[model samples]
Target: MFRHIWIRLKFQNPDKRRPFYEEETRRSIIRKEEEQQWRKKKARRQSETVYDDHEADAGQNDGFTPTEGGPDPLICDVAYYARRVGLDMEEFKVQTEDGFLIDLWHIYDPAEYTPLPPGDRTPLGPSTIPTSPSSPPGPDPETKKKPKYPVLMIHGLLQSAGAYCTNDDASLAFYLCKSGYDVWLGNNRAGFNPQHTLLSYSDPRMWAWNIRQMGVLDLPALAARVLTATGAPKLGLVAHSQGTTQTLVALAKEQRPDLGERISVFCALAPAAYAGPLIGKMYFKFMRLISPAAFRVFFGIHAFIPLMMTMHSLLPGGLYGALGYRVFSFLFGWTDDRWDRGLRDRMFQFSPVYVSAESMRWWLGRECFAKQKCILQTKEEWREEDNQDKVEEEKRSSPDASPAEPESGAGEIDKSESHNHKASTAWYDHRVPPFALWVAGADLLVDGKRLLRRFASGREPHVRVVHQKVIDEYEHLDVIWAVDVVEQVGREVKEVLWATCEGREGWRIPVGCEEVGVWDGKSEGVVGGGKEKEGEGNGSGESEVEEVGRARVRPRSRFGGWFRG
Candidate 1:
C-alpha cells in the first residue's frame, strides 16, 4: 500500500529479520566466519562481472574504498533496533552533494488488512461522502488510501538516529510510527555509519567538512529523498539540541527557504543556541583557549572522537551504561533522572560517531557566536575570541605574575552572557519556521530563555511559538530518554505532528492543554502543585505511584516533572 519509488530497496524480504551484528551473542565468532565466506563469494562474483572494469575504475578514481575487506556486518540504527523488537524496517541511503552517503531508516505499517473471519466481512465502506447533491461521488472503498503523513526525526550533536529509539516503545520515533505515521530517522554526515560514494574513510577530504555542510547539503538531501519516497509534498520535523541548530542553519543561514516550506512544523527539544551556560565550559576552554588544532594534531584526519566507538565496542553491555552516564554527565550537565539505566548501553551504541575536527574547531574558534557561521556554536568561543586582546594586554602588563592564574581565569567568563543576538536576528529576518519549543529547565548546556525571548516575545514575533512547555527538572538528554517521556515529551510531539497533518490554521494551541510551568527569564518554576499518578512499573516490582488526572503538577527537586497535552 505504501508507494516508495525512489528508495533503493536492498532487503527484498524485510520480514525475515535476523541479527546482523557479529557480537550480538556469544556465537559471534561463528557468525563472523560465515560472513567472511559470503564476502569471498561476493568478491568472486564481482571479479567475474562484465561491469567490473567500470565499477573498479569508479571506485578507485572517486576515492571509494568499498569497505576494504567487506561491508560492515552490523548497522547500529533504528533498523537494527526495529528488527530486535519484531518490527520491519527498510534501509535507504542518500548521497549529499558533497559525497557523504548518509543512512536513512524507515519503519512503516500498512493500513490494509484482510477480514478477520469469513462471516465478519462487512459491506464496502464509502471512501468519500458527497458534501451535497451536486458534489461528485467518491472512489471505490476498496481502493487503498494515501499513505500516512511522513515524520522525520533528526538527532543532536554526537548522536545518530539511534538516539530517538533508545527507549524502544516509548521513544519518539517508535511512538510516531505506532501512531500511524510513516517514521523516518535521519543521520548526518560522519554519523555512526560514516560511508560515502566518492570519499574514502582514509582520505582527509572525507573528514574536511563541518556542520555548515550538514545544514547546506545533508539535511536538504535527506529531506528531498524522504519526500520523494513518501509521495508527500511536505513532512513534519522533530529535532533536538544541535539538531535544532542545523535545521535553523538550513532554513535561515544557508537561505534555503524552500526547505522551510517543505517542513510542516519543527518541534525543537533543548534547542542548542546561546550556549554560555554550557556545563562543560572548562572542557571547551581547554580546547579553544589552549589550541584550535589539537583534535586534528592528536586524532589525525581519520575520525574525531573515535574512542566513543571503542568504548561502546569494548565495554560490557551492562557495565557501559553506568560508566557512560558518568562520562556524559561530566561533559554535559547532570539530569535529575538519568535515562532508564537499562537503556544506557543501547543508547550509547550509536552516539559520539566520527565528526570532523574542523567542525569541532569551528565550535571552538573565533567565528562561533559572533558570526553565527556554524551550527552548534557555544558562548565559550565568543568569550575566548572577544577577550583575546584584553588577555594579551594583561599578560604584557603583568609579565611576572603566575601563568596559572591567567590559564585558570574562569572569572572572566560571564554566566549570564548568552550572546545570541546575531543568531536570533538571522532567524527573525529569514522568517524561521513555527516551532513547538521544549524548554529543559535544568539544562546547563544552553540558555533556553535567551532563545525563547529572541524568537517568541519580541516587539514583532518573527517566528511563531505556537506552543511552549518547560519540563522543570529535565536536562539535555533527559528530554529524549526519560522513563516517562511518553507521557511527558512524546505525547506533545505526537499531538503537534498530528495537528500539523490535519492542516490546522495559524497560532492555535490544542484543546485540553494545561500549562504546568512558566519561564521567568532565569529558571522555569512550576507554578502549580497538583499531584499526579505515574505510569505502571518498569517490571521491577517497585512500588508504582498512582496516576493523577490531567492537572498542573509541580517538579520534585530530586525526582523529575511531567506534562501532558
Candidate 2:
C-alpha cells in the first residue's frame, strides 16, 4: 500500500497540484447545466408527448446535450450518465435459473430507438423466454433498417453493469452503441439491488452460490435475454477480469459448454484464468489460510462485507470514491495511472456492489481457485504439463542426441501420462466460440500471458484464437478505464467482433468496421512476438506516461515475429 502511494506521489505533476479541485469546480458547473436541460426535456416529454414511435425516433437526438466535463459527483445513476452522453439506457430485471434477479442495461442512441415503457420494465421470470412478435410492432421493415447486432458485456468482480457506463463517451457500452452495435451490460446475481423470487435477503440460500453458479446460470440467463431481445441467433460476448473467468469456466466442456454455441465471438479483456503474483499478497494469503467454517464466520454466509455497501450509501460520492480507491489499491495493487483521473470518482460508484461471501471464498479460500492457481487444473497437474513441455522442447533442440533407455515402471508412467493428458488437456469442446484476448501485460492480478500460451500451444485444440494482443503498459482495469482504451482495446474489439461475426449478412455493420474482412482463421498469432524491449516498465509501480511510447507498439511486419496455427 505504501509502495502504491509512493508511486502516485512520485509521478505527480508539480504544476497540477490542484487538479482534482479544479476538476470538481468545472464538473459542478457542467452538471448543474446538464441537470437543468434534462429536467426541461423531461417536463416537455411528460406534458406534451404521447407514445409515438416515429416521433420519438425522429426527436431522439434533440434533447441530448453532451456534458463538457466528467460526470456529476452526486449522481450515481447509469441512465443519467447515459443521457449526458447523448445515449439512453433501459434497465431490465433478468432472473437466473436459481431465481436471482440481476440487472441488464441496454444502451442505445435516443435518436435511433424508442425507450420501453415503465409498465413493460418488470422482472423477467426464470421460465420466460422472449420471442419476437409475429407481426411488425413499430416502423415498417421496408422503411426502417434492421437493428444493430447485439453485444453482451459482463463486468468484473464486485461491480455492477454501471461500470461500463462511467467513462462517458469513451465507455465501452456507449462506444459500441454509437458504433452501431446494440450493447447490453450484464450484472451478476446479487448486484446493487439483490433480489430473489422465493427467498429474502436473510435467506442463506439466496447467497449460496460461487463462480460456478455465475458461469452456468447468471451468464447464460443474461445472454439468452440479449439474444431474445435482439432476435439474434448469437451475440458477441465481451468480458473483463472475473467476467472473463466465469466465461472461461462456462465454455469449458465439463460445465455449460452449450452456452458457447449461442456466442459469435468471446472478447476477453484482462482475462483472468491463471492467478498472478498478487494472489500471494498478505490479505489473499490470509483468506487462503482460513478454514471454510472460519471464512463463513468472518465474512458471513450472506453478503461479503455488507458494510461496504452500507458505506456506499452513507458516504458522500467523492469521499466514498476516494476511500474506495485507497482500500482497493491496498487490496489489489491497482493504480489509476492510465485511467481518466477526472472520472475516477464516477468509476468507483459502480463497483463494490453486493457479492456473496461464498463467491469470495471460491476466489480466495483455502480449497478453491486460490489454491489451484489455474481455474481448471491443480498446481501439480499444470506443473507436470510444463515439465513435459520442457522435455519436448529439449528434444526438438537436440535431434542428434541419443534417446534415454526406458527405466523400470516406464509402462506405468506412460499410462499415467495418458490419463493425466486426457483429464487436463482441453477445457472447451468444438461448441466453443472463437476467442479474441486483450491481455494486460503488466497486470499483476491475473496471468493472462500464461492463458494465451495455453491456447497458442495445442492444449485447447477446439479453441480458435482469432485475435490476440498484449498491452505492456496496462494493469487489470486499464482495458476499460484507461483514457486511450478506445484506441488500444475498443477499436480492436470492434473489428474483431465484426470479423468473427458468423451471420453478418442480416445485421447492420458497426461503424469503423465496414471494411473489416471476415477473419480467415489465419490471423491467430501473437502481437510483437518477441522478448520485451529492455528498460520497459512491466507494470511494477512505473509511471504510465513514461512508457507511453512503448505501449502497444507492434512490429512493422511479421517477418521476424512468431505466428500460431
Candidate 3:
C-alpha cells in the first residue's frame, strides 16, 4: 500500500489536481449563497402566513430549501443529507432470518409524504415468501391518491445506503423520488452498528458469514420489508457492485430463487459477475496464495481492517476524507475524474463501513473466488465449457465437412447432447426477473461485458435482458457518481422501471415517463418509446429521441444519447 501511494505521489501531476480543488471551492461558495437565500425566503414566508404551530411546522418543511447551515462536512447521516436537498428519510430496522438488525431508509419528498414518527417506524421481522401480485396501498387512504411505485436501492461493498444520498439533487435516490418513485435504500447486515438478537459482537459465530449469507438472508429480508411497507407485491431492484453480486447469487435456482418473484426488474450498475484483470495484482495474488489460517491472522475474524474504522471515528472529517481518498485510490485505482469534485469528500464519509473478515476471505482467500476467478463456477469447469464451444465453432466454420449418415444409435446421442447442453449452460430458473444492465466499459474491477455476453449468448436461458448499454467512458463507480449520471443512468433506470413494471393498474406514473410503454419483448422502442435519430445531435454531445413505435404505451420525450464517444 505504501509503495502504491509513493508511485502515485511521484508520477501524478500537481497541476491537474489544482482544478478539482478550485471547483470544490467554487461549489462551497455557491452552497453558502444558496443557503442564505433560503433562510431569507423562509423568514419572509413565516411573517406572511398565519397558522397553528403544527401547521406552521408542516409548511416550513414543505418547500425546497438548502439546509440551515449549508452542507456539514462531518455529517454522515443519510437523513441529514436528504434534508440538505429538501427531501426526508425515515429509518426502519429490518431483522434478517439470522436475527441481524440492518437499516432500511425510505427517501420521500416532504410535501408529498408525511414523515413517520420515531415510534411508528417499527422494526419488521422476517416475512413469509410472497407468491401473488397485489395493489399498493396509498400513503393516506382518505385522500385516495395512489402510492408511488416502490423501488429498492442497494449499496456497493464497504458502503452504506448514504452513498446514494450524497450528491443532493443529482443523487440517484433523490432524483428517483422527484421523478415519482418510492425509493428505499437497503443496507446489508452489520453496517455501522453490529446488532443481533442473540449473538454478541465478540462471538465468532456472529462473524461466520460470507456473501452467500448476505445473498440468501440479508437481501430477502430487506426486499420483504420494502414490499410489506409499500403494500406492493413487487418492487424494482437496483444494485451496484457487491449489491449486484448478492442479488445475482440469490436469484440463482439453487439459492433463494423465490426472492426474484418479489422484484419487478433488476437494474444492475457495474455488475460484478466475473473477475476483472485487477484480480491478478500483486497484493491480490498474495492474498490468493495465503492459507485460510494466515488470512484470519492478517485480518482479524471480527472485521476486515478494523483500523480503517478507528481512523474514521477518530480523525477529523476533512482529514479522513483526504486520507481515505488517497488510500482507496491506491488500492482500487479509483479517481475523481468523472465525479463532482465538490461532493467527493461527502461520498467517502459513507464508505469503509463494517464488513466481516470472513466475507473478505471468501472474496480473496486461496480456495474461494480469487482462485477460481468466478463466484459460482470452478476454473476447470469454465475451461471445459470453453473447449466445448470451440469444437462447436470449428464444426460450423469448416466448409469441407460433410454430414455423416445416421447410425442406429443417433437418436440416443442427440438426447444425451441436449441434456448435457442444458445442464452445463443454464444458471437461473423461470422465476428470474427481467434484467437491465449499465456496464462500465472502462472498469477494471469487474468484467461486466463478459456477463452481458453470457446473457446474450443464451447461456442463462431464463434470463430476459430487456435493456442493455455499455457506457464506453465510465469507470466502476461512475454509473452512480458521474456528473451526468442523471441523464446517462438515472433517466434510463427510471424509464426501465416503468416499462418493465408489473401490475401497474393502480400505481402512480412517474413524471417524464407517462408515455413509456410496458416492454413486451416484441419491439425495441417500448423501453425508450422512440427510435434513435441517426446523425442528429441534441447540442449536448447526445442524439435526440424520435417517436416511431405504435406500442400502446409510448414515451413522449425519450432520454437519449446514453452512448458517448
**Highest lDDT model number:** 3
Write one digit per residue (lDDT tens) for candidate 2, span 251-352.
888778888888889999999998999999988999999999999989999999999999989999999988988899888999877676767888999879
* Tens-digit lDDT track of model 1 for 524-550: 222222122354212221111111111
lDDT of 3 at 565: 6
Model 3 misplacement above 4 A: 1-32, 38-63, 66-69, 130-133, 138-140, 391-420, 423-425, 521-526, 530-565
TM-score of 2: 0.80
Lowest-lDDT window of 10 residues in candidate 2?
Answer: 556-565
The TM-score, computed over Cα atoms with residue i paired to residue i, of candidate 3 is 0.83
True-structure lDDT of candidate 3: 0.76
- Counting clashing residue pairs in each candidate, in order, gives 3, 0, 2
Worst 10 contiguous positions by lDDT, candidate 1 = 556-565
Clashing pairs in 2: none
Residues 1-565, candidate 3, lDDT per residue (tens digit)?
4765775889964434442466456656766676665565567576886545443233334255434443466567888888777788899988888889899999988876887778766665664555555555644676677789999999998999888987777899998988889999999988888888899989988899889888989999898888777778899999999999899888877788988888889999999888888888899999999999999988889978877888888888878878888888887888788687767888889879989999998888887878777676766655555565556656666898787877999968876665456534466788999898888878888988777765654456578887777777778898898777876788789888989887676788888777788889533334554232454211133221121111111111111111000
Show pairs that collide, candidate 1. 533-546, 533-547, 533-548
Off by over 4 Å in 1: 1-77, 83-86, 110-143, 335-338, 366-431, 502-565
